[model samples]
Target: MLHVISQDLSSFNTLGLRSNASALVRYEHAGQLPALSQLAQTYKKVFVLGGGSNVVLAPDLSALVVKVESRGVRLVAESSDAWLVEAQAGENWHEFVGSCVDKGWLGLENLALIPGTVGAAPVQNIGAYGVELEQRIQSVTAWNLQECRLVEMNAEACRFSYRDSFFKHEPMGRWLITAVRFRLPKAWKAVLGYPDLRQHAILAAAGENATARQVFDAVCEIRRRKLPDPAVLGNAGSFFKNPVVSPARYEALHKAHEQLVAYPQDNGDYKLAAGWLIDQAGWKGRRMGPVGVHDRQALVLVNHGGATAQDIAQLAQTIRVDVAARFDVVLEQEPVAIA
Candidate 1:
């Protein structure tokens, strides 16, 4: 069964911006997606919404907003080298990762506290603690809205790259991801190369032998200390993506600004820390009207209260302009601005 309601979306989005969708459709089962897609045809536009962690909606959405609420988690298969687990799109991401750790599954520990739903994970190729969702993803099951059929795509077919995927590019909005399948290694090896994780490993005395639970706890602790809780202060985590530049450009910038923070990629490119650039540009903790840059983490944009989407967008633009002027690097927003 599907329920349709006209509602305020301020409570849905993590940023707490006030917005109203013309009509919202809620579906709890993947089987309902086909009907939902058919219903969408009656509207001029349709928008798929998940946990609402990565979107900033306009003042009024004239389209039909489909809220995915399907939920389940189960082991699909076990091979000699790995375990295949599947989770519905609507499952809370952190909770799913925690469940994996509790069940002795190891690969998702590093992505502990990332905010969003499982289905939204592949759309952004969510990454943290040096481990990305793409690394553990085996396949994705989706409802092809365009063709009105169910479809499955292997990880490679997703074309994942640095916070991007085919779902976010060419095939955007044509498919609604119903669930994700992850391949967790049986011979679990901890990923501790990330700086904060390494430091926490030393503090916990786990080092290279850290259990998946320990790593998960450490990652959660680090995230808690750095990012503001949306419950306390409205925010979409890591508001901008780190800018990647050529090695020669990085070298030139390094010589000019000796303290430029960056990490070299395997392809010889360099990912400059967007937070460092924004902070250096003097945007950290700066506020205008009802929105501002987060005090603790410059990468976050916060809505103080009663702020509109335009207020947040303006603040972001100001910061981007300043960062570009200061560092000559362009910062790309991580959140999707729905208009």
Candidate 2:
């Protein structure tokens, strides 16, 4: 089992801020379930953490952080075309994708290089480069702290939406996911729906053809060049999710702002590009104290130096208010705020 007796948690989080925890518990395996669960009874402040990819703290949280590190994978079924595989929660997400790629699995190629762990993937229904994790998810096995038993939750039960899931809404901090099961295909089928990805794949193939592996490689290259490395430059990826707006509202905005780029959703709505909007408003590379919006993608607010959690919040508020006033649209942050 994982153990932590230190009062400070500066190194543990990706944000690189010095904060204290009353106590920190790390679970290296699922077998440590009872011990980890027992802490909730003894402590008032408790939270589950993954790779620290999508969170901003109000302060070095004074809670007991249960760092779930259950790690492993097992293949439950396989055929010529597809394989059913289950991965433990703590497995680093991109590394897990890399393993599947090395094994010639085609489904996860489009989601390469996303931060966080497998267990946390389903919570946000993490997506990228025209693919979402929900497409490959078969079911998730979680330890329901309320019921004190293991339960298998299917995709529908997960309630996935654009960057949201059941765990993100209802039953919010109740169940801790232990493992995730995915049904991956052996045959490559590249999803080139996203314009930039398609263009990249086409350019790379010289108008011939690009496979899933090629698409994955191209997407990784794009992300690496566009986004700063979190390990080197503290960030939580995209700080704001692309906002989904109704079609009529989109039309009005389009008429008002002709240059606005939006994607029409199946539900007769539109998903506006938050990054473009932020950049248009001139927030990119703007700094206040040690935190600011990323120079490349304004949606990604970054921490440059000794930025407290409140520093991140203040910058976000300014962006939100300005964007709302200028465009008449509300921008919602993608990262989890632990205040």
Candidate 3:
């Protein structure tokens, strides 16, 4: 059975933008998805919502909003080499990570404190501290809206990339992720490549010997210092995706601006820091109406209070135009924009 409600979505989205959903449906089990899909057939448009941490809802959403709230986590399989952990779509990402670490599952330690749900992770290919969701993803179970059936997709089939997946592109709205399974290696090793994590590990005197719990704690601390809690201040965490450029382009930028922050990629491209670019454009801590760039981290855009979706869109566009003019690079927004 599907429970539909007409409600204001301001409380649902992290941005806290004023919006209204024509119809909203909440599902607590995978078995309900097929019926929900059938219910969606009655609507002109349908949109699936997760934890609402990575989206900008339009003021008037003339669509059926499906909120996934299915929840559970368990060890599905184990071998001599690895442990297969599975979690339902609606489980809180940070909580799930913490639970895994508590149980001695180590791979998700570096991704601690990331917002949103397990289902949304694969869609965004969420990453932090040199660890990405794709790295641990063994498989995904989803409801295929097009064929009106359930299907499973492996990591490679998801076409994981930098902040993107097949879920975000080709099959976009056709698949509703219900659960995700991760492969945690038995021989756990710390991912200390990220500077912040490395520094924290050193400061804590854990270094290479840091347990999964220590890494999780360090990540939480780092994130707490850098990002404002959405409950206290509205934000979508890293509004813009770091732009990747060719080695030649990076060299040219480096020559012009010696302090330009960038990281060398495995494929020879350079991932320029979007925050540095935004700060260079003089948008950090700057406010335009109800929207502003966060002072501590320029990559974040904050809602002062009572901001409209249009206001946020305008502010983002202005920043984009200015960054392009100054750096000849376009900064793409991380959150999905509903219109």
Candidate 4:
């Protein structure tokens, strides 16, 4: 096992917050799980770092950081209706989706260009363009640190909800996902029900006869245009989740604000557009010291430069408070803050 003391993690996270791990361990194979478990036992705190797209890191971590880097993809099973494909946790999510689309494995196209690794997808229940990762997931293989063994969990066992899953609720370093299996349907259908996707010029041009590739390209283009590139300007895509409200609450909010942007859920609840709320709350293009809300997309919070995790947290809290005061709705941040 390769270990580095006092490792800098500024480049590991998408937010680019200057942080350091007391010790960093490179996890490239399944054989390392046992050692990782031992190390986790040794350290009072331990963090499993994937692609680092959905995290806000503190200035210093007094913990052992395990960097998941296992990689591979293969068709594990096949049937007339669907194909079961397995991908190692370390694979870049966007590239994996692109490969599936290229091979005509149709389901992940709507989620193209999402930043992160395969392992982290299910944890966040990553979703976009009217579809969530749970819809495509067959099973998740993870190392259970407490038991010190590998285990496979089905979709139902995963307990997937909007932008959340069982993994998120588990104790830190308790479960480290190593691979994910996806069930891609052979009978594919376009999911352009999302307003942004449905109204996109590219998709509109494609019309009713839109192919999987077009949908993939459209999502990529839309994300590229709206989201800031973490490489150039650090950001963790949408900083806040679209708040889901009860039907009665939705009706009340809608009555008060005529221009409320929301979508109806099958469960009769309504998912309010957090971006619209933030914009209406007067936070778009606004800054707080080194961090600020992305001007183009109100949902995103960007790190201008030299911003710390505390800076991001303070700004997020300020926005949450302001939005709550104005709209009487609580906005929840999506990114996990690691101290």
Better of 1 and 4 by lDDT: 4
**Candidate 4 C-alpha lDDT tens digits along 75-130:** 99899999999999999999999999999899999999999999999999999988
Model 1 residue 199 CA deviation (Å) reads 1.1
Between which residue pairs do clashes occur in model 4? none
Model 1, span 1-339: residue lDDT tens: 667899899989999999999799986896787788788778777788888899988999997888888899999999999999999999999999999999987799999888889999999999998898999999999888767998899999999999999888753357788999999999988888777887774434976667888888888999999999998999999999999999999999999999999989999999999999988888889899999999999999999999988998899998888888877888899999987
Error of 2 at 237 (Å): 0.6
User: Between prediction 1 and prediction 3, which has the larger lDDT?
Assistant: 3
Candidate 2 TM-score versus the reference = 0.95
Error of 1 at 138 (Å): 0.3
Error of 2 at 211 (Å): 2.5
State model 4's lDDT: 0.93
Question: Clashing residue pairs, candidate 3?
Answer: none
- The number of residue pairs in model 3 that clash at the backbone is 0
Query: Residue 80 of model 2: what lDDT?
Result: 87
lDDT tens digits by residue: candidate 3, 270-334: 99999999999999999999999999999999999999889999999999999999999999999
